[model samples]
Target: MFGGGGGGGRKPLDYEELNENVKKVQYAVRGELYLRASELQKEGKKIIFTNVGNPHALGQKPLTFPRQVVALCQAPFLLDDPNVGLIFPADAIARAKHYLAMAPGGLGAYSDSRGIPGIRKEVAEFIERRDGYPSDPELIYLTDGASKGVMQMLNTIIRNERDGILVPVPQYPLYSAAISLFGGSLVPYYLEEEANWGLDFVNLRQTVASARSKGITVRAMVIINPGNPTGQCLSEGNIKELLKFCFHENLVLLADEVYQQNIYQDERPFISARKVLFDMGPPMSREVQLVSFHTVSKGYWGECGQRGGYFEMTNLPPKTVDEIYKVASIALSPNVPGQIFMGLMVNPPKPGDISYLKFSAESKSILESLRRRARLMTDGFNSCRNVVCNFTEGAMYSFPQIRLPPKAIDAAKRAGKAADVFYCLKLLEATGISTVPGSGFGQKEGVFHLRTTILPAEEDMPAIMTSFKKFNDTFMDQYDGYSRIIQYYITPSVKT
Candidate 1:
C-alpha cells in the first residue's frame, strides 16, 4: 500500500525544502562565533573558549567521588574483585554496589524510561533536604541533560505556532533554539540591567499582555534562578512574586535551578521555585503548575560531558503526567552512567563516609576558586574602557555591556554584522577570547554585551583577565577614541 520506491526520486534533502522550524533554530552558544573560535584553535591560536558553560573543558577537575563510583559502575567486574577496595574507598565501593544492585543488568543496559528508580529516590531526598519540602520520586524524570527535559516540556506545551512561552531576554540560547525548533513563539520579558539584572513584575505583565494582544496563547514562564550569562540569583521574595504572577496569569512555571549550588553572594542566595510555592501555601501550591529543572552539568561538580539532569513536576494533571511519560518512553532510557553521576551529585559522601573528607575539600576548593575568578573577571570588565559588568552572583558567566562609538557601529554595518558580533570577532582575533555577542542572547536593541564564563583555571585566570583588559583597552581607544579626534578637529575654535 505504501509507495516506498516513489520516494527515491526525491533526491537528497534540499536545504530549501527543509523544515523551516529547523532553519529558525539558532543556538548562539555554539553559533558562527564558536565555529570561528574552533577554526582559530585548529590554526594553533591559544583560544580561551568562554562561549558555553563547559567547566571540565576549561580545566575544572571532576569531583573524585562521583568519578570513582562511576568508574566502578562502568566496569562492574572490578566491584566483585576482593582487592578492588585497595584502589577505591569503601564508601565509593559500597555506593557503587548499591546502585549496581538496583540495575542488575548493569549500567550498559537500558534503564527505566524515567531513570534508575533508586537514583531518582536519591534525587528526591536531596531536594527534600535542600528545600525542606517533600519531593515525590514518581514526579521526577531523569534526562540526558536539563536541556533535553526543557525541550520535552516545551514540546508538550507548544501545540501550534501561536502557543507562546514567556522567556527572558538575554536568556540561555537553548530556550530560543528549542522554541524555534518546536515552532513556538518566544515572548520576551527583559531583566533590568540597572538593577543587577533583576526581574520587574510590571514589565512581565506588559510583555505577557503584548503577546496575548498578538493572538498568541502564552503557556509557560521560564525562570533561570542563579541565571546564566547575567548570573543574578533570585531571592526567595522574588520567587514568591513570580509564583503569584504565574498563579494569577494561569501560566506554568519552568524553573531552571542548575546553578543552585554555584552561588557566591550570601546576600542573594539561591532559592528554588518549588520551595517558595509551598511556603506561600493553599491556592498557589495546590494549583499552579510548576516544573523545576536541575543538571549535573553546572555548579562546582561541572560534569557537563556526563549529561545528567532531572526535572520534577508539581500540580500537573495525571493525564498530562502520563503523556510526558509516553514521550520519554520513546527515548527508551536516559544516559545510564549519567544517572549514576546524578545520584552521586544529589547524594554525595556524607559525614561518616570514607570519601567525605576528600570530597568536601575538593568541592570546596573548586567553588572558592570560582568565586575568586568571578570577582576577578567582573572587576576586570568594570575597569575596562566603555565596559560595565554586574557581579556574577551564582552562574558561571559574566555579561559585560560594551558602549561602542558610532564609528564602530558604522564599521559593523559595513561588515554586515551586529555591532556586538563585530566587536566579539575582533576580540577573538586579537586575544583569542571567544565570547557570545549580546545579540545572540536577545539583548534590548541598541545596547551591546558579551557573555564569558569564569571557568578558566585559577592560576591562569589573572593572566586571562589581564590579556582581555589589554585587548579591550586598545579596542575602546581605537573605536571610542576616533570620536574624540573628530570632535577636536570640528570644535569651533575655542578662544583661550
Candidate 2:
C-alpha cells in the first residue's frame, strides 16, 4: 500500500557501464576471504589470516629508531619538551633535523614533484653502495610506493594504440591492473615452474614475437626479482642473461627489487639489476635502460602502511629522466614523513653509533624469523597429500599447486568460481584460513594453485598448517573424480 505501481519514477544505477577491461578483471580472493572471515566472526569463529603480507597485523613491531624518527618528524614540538628528552635518541633528533632541513617546505609543507633532494641524494648513495656503480640523484624519484612509480612509468611508455608490456605469468597484480586501466596490451610470458620458477628465454622470445605479430609494440619487460607469489630468486647468471636479452631486444627493463632484503637461502643472494648492468660492461650496460624499484614495504621493515619507496634509473636518456620528473611533479611531492622514512630505511644507524648493535641484531632476528616461517609453511604444504610446494627462497608467499577432484571443479564451475578460488573458500570455511588463488595472478590454463603469506605468528603457524592439511584431505575425499583428473595430468602413467 505504501508503494503502488506508479509511486515515483526512479531508475537504478548501472554501475557496469564502465571500462570493459575493468569488468574483465577480478579481485575475488581478497573480498571473499574478508567476507567469509567476517561471517565466521559472527558465529564467534577464530580466523587465521594468510591472504596478505602484513607483518604488523600479526604483531611484528617496527625498529625503535625508525619509528622514533618518524614520530619526531611528524611532530617536532614533542621533542622540545624536557620530559621527553630521555624517551628519544639524541642521534635520532639530529637525524630528524637533518631530514627537515633537507625536506622541501621544511617537513611541514609539500616537496618538489620528484621528491626531497636530501632523500634522493641518500637514495643515490645507497644505490651506489649496493650496486658498486655511480648513480645520479636526478635519476631517482621518491614515490608513495613502488606501485605508483611502476604505474607512472607504464603510463609514459604505453601510449594507447599498439603499446604492450611483457609481464611474467603469475605476476604481481599491479602490473596487469595498470596496463588494463591504461588500455595497453598485456603480453604475458610464462615462468617455468618445473625449473624452480625460472625465466624461460624460449617462452619470452615466443611471447614477444607473437605480440609483435599482432601489431603490438612490446615497450618494456617487467621482472620481479625474488619473484612474487612463486618466491624464486634470480641468480647472477640469470640476471646477466636477462640483461643481455633485454639489451638485444631494445626493451626497457623494469626491475622490481622490493624484496631485496628478504632472501633466506645462503646460495642465492640478492643482486641489483643496475649492478648486473654495470658488471656486464660495454653495450649491454649502455644499451639497456633499467629502472630498479625499491620499497620499505617488504624486507625487514615490512612497513606497508608507510607507503615509502623509490625508483632509480640507470643509463636513461636525459630527456626521459626529465619526462619522468615532469610526470611525478603532478603529485607535487611524495608524503614528507614517508620521504624521511625512506631515508632512514636506506641509511640506518652506522656500526659506531649507540643504537647500531641492538638495531642490527633486532633486524637480523626479524628476517631470520621470517625465513623460518617461510620454511615452515612450505614444508607443511609439501607434507600434505596431493599438494606440491617449492621452497620460498625469497619473498613472502608460498604458491602451492593443489590437486582438486572432479566434483570440486564441477562445483566451482556451477558456483561461477575459479577452481582454486572454490578450494580456498572451502578452506576458509572449514579452517578459518584465507588465501589468494593462483588464477588471480594468472597461472596456466588448467592448473589450480593458491598463494598464502608466511607472515602469521610463528607460534600459530603449525596450527594453520594442520588446518590447511586437514581441509585439503577432506576436499580430496569429497571430490575423488576431480582428484583423479588432476592426478592423471600431473603424474605420468607407467606402461607394462
RMSD of each: 4.7, 4.3
Model 1 scores worst on lDDT over the 10 consecutive residues at 487-496
lDDT of 2 at 103: 60
Q: List the residue pairs that clash in candidate 1.
A: none
- Candidate 2 lDDT, 406-470, residue by residue in tens: 67889999999889889888898888887888888888877888998889988888988998888
**TM-score, every prediction:** 0.95, 0.93
Candidate 2: lDDT of 3? 45
Global CA lDDT of candidate 1, please? 0.90
| Candidate 2 Cα outliers beyond 4 Å, as residue runs | 1-16, 19-25, 28-31, 38-44, 104-106, 481-496
Error of 2 at 239 (Å): 1.1
> Which ten residues in a row are the worst by lDDT in model 2?
487-496
lDDT (C-alpha) at residue 459 in model 1: 92
Candidate 2, after superposition: displacement of residue 262 in Å?
0.5
Among these predictions, the greatest TM-score belongs to: 1
